[model samples]
Structure formats: structure tokens, C-alpha cells
Target: SDIFGEIFGGGRGGRSTVFRGADLRYNLEISLEQAAHGFDTKLRIPAMATCESCKGSGARPGTAPTTCPSCRGAGQVRVSQGPFSIAQTCPRCHGSGSIIPHPCAQCAGSGRIKLQKTLSVKIPSGVDEGDRVRLSGEGEPGVNGGPPGDLYVQVHIKPHPVFTRDHDDLHCEMPVSITSAALGGEIAIPTLDGSAKIRVPAETQSGKTFRLKGKGIKGVRSQAPGDLFCHVVVETPVNLTERQRQILREFDAISQQDSARHNPRAKGWFDKVKEFFES
Candidate 1:
């Protein structure tokens, strides 16, 4: 019947339509250090795979599918109503062009089975948040001999304990002793590689920023590595002993005598207040 209708171009092609498979997405989370340095990982994905019971033929043992006798291997059938003919899917074969009389017990005549598949993925260095790593032909199987779709791995970076990332740069707060802020010292700071010493000049004030070159992450597109910014936070001495309190009182008395020279910023601030009130 299909051969007779095709000779007049009134029936569909004998084969089913080819369609690409659907794409898939997987969320991948990694540490900041891993994001800085590339790593390879394996993923266990569960999806539809070709049945091994009947070699994806959906047939029972020693049996095979046969062409639909109603549609004559054509997925579509034409119905005639007096003078007009309407083409529709073959109800007998369900547009498969063939009928599986003895269905496979494993796949249940679907020609596919749910199974777990292992896939390898490579995560490049310096991959930021929301970056996608695509793997070709790693998605679901195609339909009717069509091409398979792709799988996308979305990257997410875990929060760092000490440092906060800003594009390629890194920022961190470094607590300094009040004496070190008043005097000079060489202190150790944390970097992505390890620890490094930074010289704190005399009279280093709070909120002062110290930049260390090439101490931050080298991004994927960056030719050179970024810098690390250290914010200084002067911590005041607490739980002072009686001797220390007495020494501080003596130091304060001396500093007050030369307040204009020792604390020029404080002197300037009070001068501004005095002028504002006088005006």
C-alpha cells in the first residue's frame, strides 16, 4: 500500500525522521585552589543507553522486528474520504515502520535502557564563576540514527577562607600590632603560592594598602598574573598589665608635648574644627 501511494507522492518516506538528541547540563563545584590550578575529574552520569539484551533491536531472542503490514514499511498511512485523502501516522507500527511482535524483556521494546556511564572532564585553570566547559557527544543518544547533543559543565568556585577574589586580583586584610604601625617591621603575609614578607614602614596607618606584584591568580586570558592587595588593620593592645599601662601613660605624656610634630594629622583636624567654630 505504501509503495502504491509513494508512486503518486501521497505517503511519507519509508524511514522515520532523524532528530538530534537533547543537550544536558551538570553543575561542577571546585575549590579556589583547584580553580587556580587545572584538574581532571570523572563524572558518573545515568541516562538512556542502547540496550544490550537484543542489540538495541527491541526483539526477543531468536526473533526480529518485521515491517508493518498495514503501512507497508511506510510510517504514515493515507485515508480516503470520497474525493480527498489525508495522510496520518500508521497506528499499527506507531510510525516506526516496523513492528516488534516479541519484545525484549530488558528494554521492554523501547530499544534503550537506563544505565550509568562514566565520563571524563578537564577543567582549565583560572576558570571563573559560571564558566562552562563543553564536552562534545556526551549528552543523550540521538533519535533514529541522528547525531547526539553536547553536555555542558558549569563551573562554580568555592569561597576562600582568607582571601577574596576580584577578577584576577586577590584582597586580604592583614592585622598589624599597634607598635608595628607606629614603628617599622617586616611581617609575613599570605599569598596563593605561600607566605611572603612585606616591610611595614614606620608610622604605617590603618587602611593602608600594600600591593604585591604577581602574587594573585593568572587568569585564562591574562598574559601576566594579577597582584595581591593587603589592607592594613592596626590592632590596639588589650588586657594590658599594670607595667604596660604605666609605660603607655608616660609615652602619652611625652607625645602630647610634641603633639603638633608627632600627630600632625590630629593637629590639622583640630585646627579645621577651630576655624569652623570661629567662623
Candidate 2:
């Protein structure tokens, strides 16, 4: 019986439709410390708000909407097709069964206005990059007072000067002196909590990894915290004095006598190159 309305009318059965507002996304950048411990901040966003001038009625002050004259409040009109009659939405009121003779000048009959609103947002701890925090009913105001949408806050951790994140683990390059790598020493590494120390064993090679347990972030759903990995990079001595240069030269000669034992990786690489060339 109402198939004609579904086929020809703009809405269902010529009745006015209510619509939920649009959802919105916001990218939020936070420091690693802030992300690790959580923080509260205020955000000012641009959105549509209900018009105060018309009280969402879209009618001018001291006036009200009047019933549609074309449909006589039935919200529908009829057209004759041979011997059959088909119902369609009223052209005058557009199926609202009413008309505003004086539209509010401020809103231009939109019943809403563009404005900025400030909202307090709480960031939960352990929110990794790409995570979304949803705030219900905080998006654009609904159409016809139906329902509002949601606001999604996307998490993006700002780049840290000393650390890089990987899921729950954190990684950092620790520069050690050539003397420290050769003779072994204790080095202090940075963690989210603070600084911690790791012992470098004797003859420690460059690119050695030292892991600190429970020094990384704990995820939102994780039962235990992650680890922090410290990659060792042996740094060469620069601006050497004449005596320093002479001492290094003597040490190099001593190491050269037993290069295979002192520089095993370089010896192995040279051996591989020699075999490849000979073959």
C-alpha cells in the first residue's frame, strides 16, 4: 500500500526522517611520558551547535511554525494516475506537515550554528599509537533532535629524543667508548621510569644488546610490562694526542700479530672474501 512512497518519495512513507549527526576524528599527539602515565587536557574543536536564536525550531523569535496548507497537516499529497491515486510528500512542507514563514536570521533556518566548543579529555595509560578513544554524543549535533554521533580521539606518540617504541618494548642506542668495550664497564641507560645500569662484559663487541626487564611500557590489556633493549655502539676516540696515537699504534701492532683472535669478525669476513675470489 505504501510502496509508492518508498519508490517515489524522498523519505519512507512521506514521513520526515530523523538523522544522527556525523562522527568526527581527531589526531592527538602526546609525549611518551604523558602516554605512559596518562594525562588530562582540554581540546577546543569546531562543530555545529543548536541555535540559541531559534531554540532549534528554525522559526523567528515571537513566531512559530504553521501547518502546511498544501497537505493540510497530512504531510502527503496525491497525484492521479489514470484510475489509481499515488501518495507523495507535500511539495510545500517537504513532508514535515509544517512551514516556517519567518526563518531565524542567525541560523538561516538550519536550526544549528557553527561554533567552537571546549571539552576535557582524559587519556588512559598504555594507549599505543593508532589507538582510538571514543567519546559518546560528543560529535556533531543530531538532525531533527534525533541523536548525536561520537568523537574518536586517535593516539599518536610524539617522537622521543632518546627512545623508539615497538609495540610494548622500547629501544635505544647506547654509545660506549672503545676502552669500555675492550675492558668492560658499567653504563647507565635510560628507561621510562628513570636511569638504570647495565654491566658490559669484557671484550664486548659493538651492536651488543642488553635487555632490562620490566623497564618498558605495559599495554592496556597486558598482564606484565615489556622490556627495554639497549644496543651498544662502540665509539672511536677522536682528537688523539701524539702520545695517545703512539700508544694506539703499538696496541694495533700487538693486535695485528694475533688479528684472528682479537678481531674475529673481521678475520671471518676477510676469509669469506678470499674464498669467494679464489673459487
Candidate 3:
């Protein structure tokens, strides 16, 4: 049935005379901060618009199109062979059912012209990458009398330098001095809003994660703000002076006197290694 319809130049009900326009797609890039907070921007698009000189009729000014003589305005022609009747588009009118005796000079009988259009776009908050924003009736102009198609704007978020985002949560690695990690202290950390302080417990180990509540992004559908996780990384001292080296050596000697109390993790690993070797 579909093949017959194609050969006859007719669809399920009949041949459609109206022409529908094609949809347009555009990719828009925005910053992560802008994605967190909504913003408005303008975009330029290259598309097709109906010709003004001919009023989309493809005919010259003050002249009207005439019905195609081949199909008698039916836009299709039929051929009979034996017991079969094959119908196809009228070659003279090319399925338009009319012929422009004097074509429009502007669009050269195409009924449309290329144009550059400027449009304003509004991005909603918490819009993630690959999200699409639709603008109704903003695509290429329709042919004949059909309505215009829609425009789709795809979203792309730029990478952030200081932090990595996961949905609404945020993660960052904070470097701390070895002494600070051992003795415990307060350190200033960066947040989306501003700088905040986090307290490190005494004997805090490297790679410990501290959660800062309500410091992350507040998504569009979220009831409460997400959390910011700071992963502590103990930094080893480098480029020590003569006096600092001597003091560290003395401190190391004092620490070795009670390895179990000062470095319980190292002592436990050594005990495990000894047991593995004996076994």
C-alpha cells in the first residue's frame, strides 16, 4: 500500500498540498556558573524566509499562477497499463498543481530566500549538558501555507577549574601541611558562594573527606542545597633548611621511640608484613 501510494504520489488519505517547514537545531555553550544560575543570551541563525516580493507565491508581481494543464490542477498524472493504473506527480507542475508563467525575480521561483536572523534565548537554572530548549515557530519559514517548525537549542556546560560537579554535589581536593594534619587545625576552603572554614580533627589522616553542608549548588528541583566534600591531602615538607632538617631528624627520633603511639598505621602494616613472611 505504501509503495502504491508512493507511485501514485498520494498518501494515506490523499496528496497533501500544504508544505511544512523543516526544524532547526543549534548548539549553545554556557559556563557552569551560568548553568547554576539562569541567564539570557542572543543567538544568530542562518535560515530561510518567505520571499516578500512574490508573497511566497513564486509568481511575478500583479500576476497569478495558472493551473497545471498536465494534471488539470490535481498535481498528479495516471498511466494505464493492462489491468494496472500507475499514478505519479505531474511533471509540468512538479506536484505543486500550478505553474508560474512569470517567475519572481527575488527568489527565482523558489518562494523563499536565505536570511540571517537574531533570536533571544533564556536558559533556565540547573540545566545540564545535552539539555534542549525549544522555541516554537522559530525555524525555517513554511512553504505554501503551512506553519513554521520549531527550533531546538542544545546546552553544553564548560569545564570548571577549581571544583568538579556531580549533579548538585561538589568535590574538591584540599592540600594541608603534614603538621596541620597531625596537630589538627582550621583551614579555609573555597565554596560556590564564598570561602568557608573546616576544622580538622587531631590525628586526621590523609585522604579524609569533610562534608560542608549546604555549600554546594542548589539545583532547580532540589528541596535543599547539596553538600561540598573536601578531600584532605597531606603535603610533605620540601626544600628544608639546615635547621629545619635537624629539627625534623630530632622529631623523627622522638617519634620512633613509640612507633605504636605516634604512627599506629605504619606499625600495624609492619606487623602484618612480619606475619605474612612467617606464614
Candidate 4:
């Protein structure tokens, strides 16, 4: 009959034990555009793998681990500390309850080796800064036929130069010439894909924003693309020739006389300031 005894090494009716390994973590940096879209990346990392020479058993190739005689295969030793009797790990077997007579030379009985490993990971779309991606069973190898640990890859997205991104939308400055802004003309605007034409309405003021539908980043939660906000910045003419400067001076003079027609906002602000000064 298979009847169990005290089970503390009594009649040898206990279950066999195994060893497990430790987990690992890594960090990765990607571009902001890459985060908007999913990407495949590879990383090189240093990890501990099981020794092949002894098949991770730590004993020599042909020899198996034998029960430790020092602790009688119990993996612990009784220590009487003053008024207490404490059971601590056996020094001979390191609490494994077994000893390798002929240890493997490669890992020196540590059962693992330090080596560089390359792992490929797939980054999902809409992953933001400080996001973590878990890779199962890709950490340190298991010990003594145990299950391996997990690998955590922390992600970071680099800042973009031209665009500022929120959750799904993008904001950027679009420079339009003074002539084009006032007279109403088509100007080239920069986008993620390429340059596109956006019409500047007549009398368009600086700091005004225009939205381009379906032109921003696409989020995983919402397939509906975000809008791209183009903030208007009226750029003054530069590197003007003598004739161009004269023409601009004449234009400025003509536009300055009639404030209501040309510069209504500025004229209204100045009129308020004059009224305050008079009061």
C-alpha cells in the first residue's frame, strides 16, 4: 500500500523538487513616429543560460547529483542559537539536498553561464512613453527543469522636431507669407506623409488654427484618425531687394492710414489705449 508517513524524510514519500530561475528587464527607445505605428525591433542583452555540458544538472556529463551526506538529503541543518533551535540551509549542498561530486567545468556548478542573447520583440501601436511590453519565457533559463521567468521591455519614444503629439492629435506651426495670408493663396503645408496644399483665406490673421481631418496619428483604440492642427504664423518678407523694399514701404503707408479697413483689431486696441490715457 502507498501510505504516507510523517513525510519529513520519513519513509521517503515526498514529491521531487525542482529549481526556477530569475526574471530580467530591459529598456528600449524608439522614434515618435514609430510609436504611432507598430514596429519590429531586436535587442542585444546579457543573460544567464543553463550550462549545456551538464544539461543544467551541475554534475559532470555522465554523473547525476547524489544525496548530500552532510545533512542526510534534508537540505537543512539544525543550529542551536542560545534558547532556539533553527533549521538553516545546509552548507555542503546549498539547501538543494544533493551534491555534485564532479561538477561541470563550464559553469563551475552554478548551472548557468553568462552569454549575450538577441531577442526580437514586436511593439504594438499606440504604445506611449514608459509603457511596458512583457515577453513570456524570454528571461533567464529555468533551473533543474523548472519554468523560465519573464522579460519586461520598457519603451520610450523620442521627441519629434516639427510635430507635438497628444493622445492622437498633432499640432504644428505653419508659416505663411504676409502677401499670401492677406491676399488668399494656396500654401504648401508639411504633413507626416508629404507636403499638401492648404488654402489661406483672405484676411487670415496670425495665430489662427486650421484643422486637417484624418491627418493626425491613428490610435489603436480608435481607428478614426485624429486631426492635424495648423497654427498660422504670418512670416514677414526677408532678403528684399531695393524695389521690393520701396514697394513694401508704400504698401505699409497706404494700409496704415485707413485702420478700420486694413487693421481693424490694431486700430480698436489703440483707440482703447487713447481713451484710457485721456481719462
TM-scores, all candidates, are: 0.81, 0.88, 0.86, 0.83
Q: Residue pairs in steric clash, candidate 4? A: none
TM-score of decoy 2: 0.88
Residues 180-259, candidate 1: write the lDDT tens digits: 99997999998878899999999999999999999888888999888899999999999999999999999999999999
What's the TM for model 3?
0.86
* Pairs with backbone N, CA or C atoms under 3 Å apart (clashes), candidate 2: none
Candidate 3 C-alpha lDDT tens digits along 139-228 = 887767889999999999888887888888889999999889989999999886779999988888888999998887777778877889
Arrange candidates by TM-score, descending.
Answer: 2, 3, 4, 1
* Candidate 2 lDDT by residue in tens digits, 244-263: 99999999999999999999
RMSD of 4: 4.4
Q: Rate the local accuracy (lDDT) of all candidates.
A: 0.87, 0.86, 0.85, 0.81
Model 1: lDDT of residue 64: 95
Q: Write the per-residue lDDT of candidate 4 for residues 88-151, one digit (tens) a residue.
A: 6678877777888988888887778889999999998877778889999988887557788989
On a 0 to 100 scale, what is the lDDT of residue 63 in model 3?
Answer: 92
Q: Model 1: runs farther than 4 Å from truth? A: 1-11, 66-73, 77-95, 267-279
